[model samples]
Target chain A: MRYAMVIDTLKCVGCSDCVVACQTENDVPVGYCRDWITETVDGSYPNVVLELKSERCNHCENAPCVRCCPTGASHIIDGGIVLVTPNECIGCGACIESCPYDARYSHPEGGYVDKCTFCNHRLEKGQLPACVSVCPTNCMYFGDLDNPNSKVSRLLKNRKYKTLAPEAGTKPQVYYLI
Target chain B: MQEEIFVSGRDIPNIDPSLEIWHWPIGLYLFLGGLAAGIILFASIVVILNKEDEYPTTVKYASIIPPIALVIGLIALIYDLKNPLYSWQLYTTIRIESPMSWGAWVLLIVTPLSFLWVFSYFSELFPTWDLKFEWLKKFEQFVKKNRKNMAYLLVPLSIILGVYTGILLSAFNARPLWNNAILGPLFLTSGLSTGAAAIILLAKTAQERHLFGKVDLALIIIELGLIIHMLMGMYAGSEVQLEAMRLLVGGEFTVLFFGFVVILGLIIPGILEALEIKGYKVPVAIPALLVLIGGLIFRFVMVEAGQITRYLY
Candidate 1:
C-alpha cells in the first residue's frame, strides 16, 4: 500500500498544534521538530495572500535520501514510509544534502539523521499519525493513496492540490490541497 | 510585486531557511582526496610509460603522498561524521547508485593498493631495511615484481578517486549550486593541476620542473574553461539554478571565486608557469604553492556556497 499525507491549507489555522503533537509523540528533542508550520505571504500590501500549512518529510516514492545514503540507513518500508536505521547511519550528511524539503536534521544525542516517520509505530497499532490525530482543525488526512476509497485518495481526487518542489522529481507523497 | 515569506517552528539547527549540513572538514577532505588522486594518477603514468628512470621523484618519492593524504583525509571525514564508529557499516553492502558508496568502496581498495605500491619500493629506498617476516618479504617481492601491473590498476582507480570527489557533490540534486554536471571534470582537472604542481615543487632538475610546469599550465587552462562552462550552464538553467549561480557571481562568494580561485589560483599561476616553460627565470615554488592554495580555496567556496543555495529559499 502506498501511504500519503494530504493537508488542507484552507482549513489550517496556523495554530501549530500538530507540531507539538508530533514532538510529544516522537520524543523529539526540545530544539528540534519533525513537523512544523509554514506561513507564506504573497503580493503587495493591499492585495496580499497568506497561506499556512504544516510541513514534514514527504516519504517520497523516489527518495533521494534513500539513494544517496552511503549505508542502507535510509530506506522505504512496506507501506512506502521512509525510515532511518539509526545504528547503521554513518552520519555523512549526504542524505541531508539530497533532501528537497529540508526535512531531516542530525540528531544531537543519537549522532544520526532523523526526520518524520509517519508515526509508523502507531500505524502498526492501527492508528493515524500523531499530526493527523492531534490536528484540531481536522485538516490533515492520512491513508493508503492506492486505495480509491481512502480519505487521502478521495480528497486528492476531488480537490485542487499541489506538492512542494514538483520539479525535483522525487514523487513526494505529501500533497497540499489549495 | 513584493512578497515576503515567514516560516515558524523551524528552530532546528542546519535546516532553517537553508541547509548548512557540510562544513570545512568535508571541503578539506575533497581537497586532500583530489591531491592524492592527482599524485597517484601522474605517478602511475610515469611508471606505465617506463619513465621511472628519468622521473624518480614523480614515480618513487611521490608514491608516499597517496597513503598519507588518504589517511588524513579519511580522518577528517570520520571526524566530521556524527557517528564515526558506525562508518564500518559502509562496507556491509554496496549501493551501486550511491556515489558515496562507490567512493567508500573505491577508497577501501585504493588505500591498501597505495600502501602496497609504496611497500614494493620500500627496500630500494632504504637498502638497510629488512622485512621482519619471510612471508611479508616474499609478498613485497611479489608486489615489486608486478609493479607495472599495480601501476596499471592505480591508473584507473586514481582517476575514479579524482572524479569521485566531484561526483560526491554533484550527486546532491537538492542543492542547486552543486547540482551542475561539470563539477566532476572540473574537480578532476583541478586535482591533476595540483598534482603537477606538487611534483614541480619536489623535482630536483630544471627539466623535470619545466616539463610538469607545462602540464600544470595546460590543466589550469582546462580548469578555467570548465569553471566558465559551469557558470554559463547555471546562468542558462532554471530560475533556481540562476539564483544559485548568483551566489558565486555578484554575490557573497563573488570575490572568493573570482579573486581567490580564478585569478590567484588559476590566472597568475598559469601565466607564471607559461613563462617558466618558455625559459624565463621564475621560482617554481611560487606558482606551485599558489596553485595548491587556490585549489584548496576553490573547494571551500564550493562547499560553503552550495550549502547555502536551496530549492525553498
Candidate 2:
C-alpha cells in the first residue's frame, strides 16, 4: 500500500505544531528538521496574499536520492517507504545532495543522512505520523493512496489539489489541497 | 484568473546553503579522477598503436600519471564520505542504476589495472627497480609480454572512467545546473585536455611537447563549444532552467566561469598555442598549467553552483 499525505492549505493555520511534534517525536537534532512550512507572499500591497505550504520528504516514486546513492543505504522497503540503513551508509551525502525537496539532512551525531521517515517506528505500532496526529488544524490527511477507500484517497478524490515541482518529474506522493 | 504568487517551501529557499552536502573533497575527487582517466586514455591510445618510439619520453612519464592520480583520487573519495569506515558497503551490493555504485566498481578495476600498466613502463625506464624485488621483476615481465593487450583493455576502461566523472554530477536531476546530458562529454573533453596539458608540461622532448600542445588547443576549442551549448541548453529551458543559467553566465559564478574558465583556461591557452604554431615557441608549460588548474576550478564551480540551483522553492 503506497502511503501518502494530503495537506489542506486553507485549513492550515501556519501554527507549526506539526513541525515541533515531528522534531520531538523523531528526536531530530537542534539544527536539523524533518518537516516545516513554507510561507510566501503574493501580489502587490493592496491585493497581497500570504500562501503557506507545509512540506517534507516527497517520497517520490522516482527518487533522485535513491538513484544517486552509492551505497545500498537508501533503499525502498515494503509499503514503498524510502528508508536509510544507518550502518551501511557511507555518509557520502549523495542522497542529501540529490534530493530536490531538500528533504534529507546530514545528522551531526550519526553523520548519516536523515529525513522524514513517515514516522516508521510509530507506524510499526499502528500509529499515525507524528505531524499528522499532532496537527491542531486537522489539515493533514495520511493514509494509503492506493486504496480508494482510504481517507487520503477519498479526500484527493473530492478536492482540488496541487503538488510541488511536478515538472521535476519526481511523482511526489504529497498532495496539497487548495 | 490565476494570481502569480511567490512560491517557497515550508522553510526552504530555492537553493538552500544550509543543506549543502557535497564539499571540497567531492570537487577534488572529481578533478583527480577525471585527470587520471584522461591520462590513462591518452597513454593507452599512444601505447596500443605501438607509437612508443615516437613518443618515447611521453610513453614512460605520461603512463605513470594514471596510477598515481587514481590512488590519490580514491583516497580523497574515501575521506569525503561521512562514514569513511563503512565504505565497504559500496561494494557489498551493486546498484546497476547508481552512478556512485558504478564509480566504486570502475575505480576498483581501473586502479590496479592502471598500476600494472605503469609497472610495465617502469621496467623499461629504470631497470634497477627490477633488481630490488623479484615479484616486481616477474610482474613487470608479465606486463611487458602482454603490454599491447593490456593497452587495448585500458582504452574503454579509461574512457568510461573519464565519462563517469561528469555522469556522477549529471545524474542528480534535482540540480538543474548538473542535469545536462552534455555534461558527460563536456567533462570528458575537459579532462582529456588537462591530460594533454600535463603531457605538454612533463614531456622532456620539444617535439612531444609541441604535439600535445597542439592537441590541447584543439580540445580547448571543443571545450569552449560544449560550454556554450551547455549554457544555451539551460537558458532555453523552463524558468528554473533559466535560473540555472544565471549561476554560470551572470550570477555569483559569472566571474569564475567567464574570467578564469573562458579567458585564462580556453582563450589564453589557444593564443599561446597559436604563437607556438607560428614558430614563436612561446612557453607551452604555462598554458598547460592554466588548463590543469582550470580543470580543477571547473569542478569546484560546478559543485558549488550546482548546490545553489533554482528548484523546489
Candidate 3:
C-alpha cells in the first residue's frame, strides 16, 4: 500500500511540536533537523500574510538525492519512504545539495546524511506517528493512500490539495489542504 | 492540579538552525585541477621550445602525472559521497544536461587519453633492440610517429579538463558567489601557473636523469603574467565578486593568496626568471618548489572563499 501524509495548513499554529517529537523519537542530532518550517512573508507591512510551511523529505517518487548519491546509501523503501542507511553513508553531502526541498542533513557525529523516515519504526508497531499523535489541532493525517477507507485517502479524494515544488518532478508524498 | 495545555508558535519543525561549512571539497578540486593544468602547461612549453632531447622526458612525465592526480582527486570525491561506490553509475548513463554528468564523462575520456599519451612517450624507454621481436619494433615505430599528433590534441583537452571544474561550480545560478563569467578565465590562468610550477619541480627532481638542457625563461614569464591576470580579474569584478577578492587580500586567505601565491609562487619565480636572463643562472629548484606550494594555496583560497559568502545577502 502507498502510504502518505495530508497536512492541513489552516489548523497548523506553527508550533514546533512535530519537530521535537521526530528528533526525540529518532535520536536525531541537536543542530540538524529532518523536518522544518519555512515562513514566507510577502508584500509590505500593511498587506502581508505569514505563510508558514512545515516541510520534510517529500519522499518524491523520483528522488534526486538517490540519483546523486554515489552509494546506495540513500534509497526509497517500501511505501514510498525515502530512507538513509547510516552504515552505508560516507557523508559526501551531495544528496543534501541535490535536494531542492532541503530535507536532508549530515549528522555531526556519524557524518552520514539523514532525513524523515515517515516514522517507520512506529509504523512497524502498528501505531500513529509521534507527530500525528501529538498534534493538538489534528493538523496532520497519515494512512495508506491505496486503501479507499483510509483517512488520508478520504481527505485526498474530497479536499483541494497542493504539493511543494511540483516542477521538480519529485512527486512528493506530502499533500497539503489549504 | 489543573491540566493546562499550552503551546507556543515559536517551535518549528525541520528548520536546521545551524549552517554547514563546505570548503574542503572546493579546496581539493582546485588543487587537483591546478596540478593537472600545471603538468600540461609544462609539457606544451617544452614542446614549443623545440628541445628535442628533453621532449620525450617532459611529455612522458607530464602525461603520467595527470592520471595520478586524477586518481587521487577521484578518491577524495568518492570519499565525500554518502555512497562512494554508486558513483560508478554516474558513468553508466550519459546526461548532457547535468554538469556532474559532463564532469564524469570528461574524467573518463581524459584518463585513458592521458595514459595513452604517456605510454607513447615511454615506449622508447623500453628497449626493442632484439630483431626476434619484429612486431614490437613495428609497434614502437608507430607510437613514435603518432606521438606528436597525440600531444597536440592532449594539450587543449587537458586545458578544457582543468577549466571545466570552475565552470561546473559557476553554473549553479543559485550560488551567486560562484556565478561569475570570470571563473573560466580564472581557472585557466591558475591552471597554467600550477602547471608550470609542477613541471619545474619535476624537472628539478629529474635533473640527475639528464632529462633536458635548461628550463626556458620565456615560459616562466608567461606563467607569472597569467597569475597577475587572475588577480586583476578578481579585483575588477562586481562587489559580490570583490568580497571573494577581499577574502584573499587582507582578509581570511591573505596569508595563503599573498604570502604563498604571490611572494613564494610568482614573485620569487619571476625574479629567478629575470636573473637567468641577465646571465646569472640562479638555481631554480628552490623557487620551483615554492611555486608548487603557492599554486596549491591559490586554488584552496579561491575555492573556499567562493563558497563561504552568504547566497541570500
Q: Say which docking band candidate 3 falls in.
A: incorrect
Clashes of each: 0, 4, 12
Candidate 3 wrongly placed segments (more than 4 Å)? A1-14, A21-31, A37-92, A95-103, A106-178, B1-26, B41-57, B126-142, B202-246
Ranking by DockQ: 1, 2, 3
- Model 1: per-residue lDDT, tens digit, B93-174? 9999899999999999999998998998888777798778999999988998898998999999999999999999999889
For residues B230-271, what per-residue lDDT tens digits would candidate 2 score against the true structure? 988988897778888987887999999888988988899888
User: Candidate 1, which segments miss by more than 4 Å at Cα?
Assistant: B1-7, B12-19, B128-134
Query: How do all models score by TM-score?
Result: 0.97, 0.95, 0.63
Query: What's the best-to-worst order under TM-score?
Result: 1, 2, 3
Off by over 4 Å in 2: B1-18
Tens-digit lDDT track for model 1 on A1-178? 9999999999999898998899899999877888888888878778888889899999999999999998999999999999999999988889989998889988878989999999999999999999999888899999998899999999998999999998998999999999
